[model samples]
Target: MGRHETISRRQLVQVQDRFIAAWGQMGAAWGVSRTMAEVYALLYITAQPLNTDDVMDRLRISRGNASMSLRALAEWGLVSRAHKRGDRKEYFIAEQDVWALSRKVMRERLRREVLPLLATLHELRDATDNRTEQPAGAPLRLASDDEPAPADARKPVTAAEVRQLNDRIDSLLELVQTVDRLGERFVGSDGKGLRLAANMLSKII
Candidate 1:
């Protein structure tokens, strides 16, 4: 059979199903959980766009879970809702271009999750250091909580342990900086090597 005539709706479905599974496997390699990977894969397929109900039905996931996962996917910019003509409910579609998808995912992840965590780690490292070096009678406390112990009353974090944690945090901060730079480079142009480098770096994390 000719290529066009060989394709059937059933075959299309099977192809899409396989693609979804492959996308899920990629997600797993990036540290996304199995359920999250599956959710992402389903969104990555389906050319006509889909609503939450459709996703729930196709994936056999609960309504609430579908809603939550869709929200996350939207936040990641991997899936976005389609504004259809006269549509009353929300519908979603994936960004199909792989390079664009990777850039969007990297940007959002850096902004929403990685950046804040890096800031918090920096703050924690600073606080830990201040407690160690502060003169008697000062208090050390987390920003979110009251001072747990007075500087005079409590034992300070040891210099060795503090130095070790600081070193680890420094290394992590440097990695994030490198990722930021690479992300900038990728955003400028499609680079397969950048993605490969990112994948290798992620394994270290």
Candidate 2:
């Protein structure tokens, strides 16, 4: 019985190691650091909260790396800190609900990536409009009798080309705005909006 228990424990460790490695790779693919992903994976699989020292020892990482990773995870809402009575040390646990986890990740990405991109697109479109509104003629030159006058040499952008470019930019802007609106309607709030989104995704997937 002792040998069987030992073998089972070893197998469990190996399985957990595989999960940690795979989660790290997935995190890298999703633009998260490997260490942070591994730490989260470890916490996610565990039933109880773990302290910084436990994380460091289990992951074979330094104190600084473990601490920083934990902090980042906490900021992302993937992990939360726990306080045990009479224990001054902090322990961390992963958010276990799949829906909540997905919501947090999407919210962070939209804030960090999508909103900035939309702002940049707006700025670029405004600049393009301003450029297109400029007059197409060169300034009048004062001719001298001694020097032969030259023709206006500036080749300004044509109205048709500007209109075409503006249309394309407008189309792109509209597309982005549509996506932004959909995200807001679906994931921006809790309760009904989230349920609606989940239902829609269920049908589509």
Candidate maximizing TM-score: 2
- Model 1 has an lDDT value of 0.75
Candidate 2 ranges beyond 4 A from true positions: 1-7, 130-154, 189-205
- Candidate 1 local lDDT, residue 59: 78
Per-residue CA lDDT of candidate 1, range 4-25, in tens?
A: 6677889988888788778778
How displaced is residue 116 in candidate 2, in Å? 0.6
The lowest-lDDT stretch of 10 consecutive residues in candidate 1 is 138-147
Positional deviation of residue 200's Cα in model 1 after best superposition, in angstroms? 17
Clashing pairs in model 1, backbone N/Cα/C closer than 3 A: none
For model 2, residues 1-205, the per-residue Cα lDDT tens digits are 3454445877887888899999999999997899999999999876579999999999999999999999999999999999999999999999987667777877787788789989877776665576555566733223345855466754788989888988988898899888777776556676456777678899999
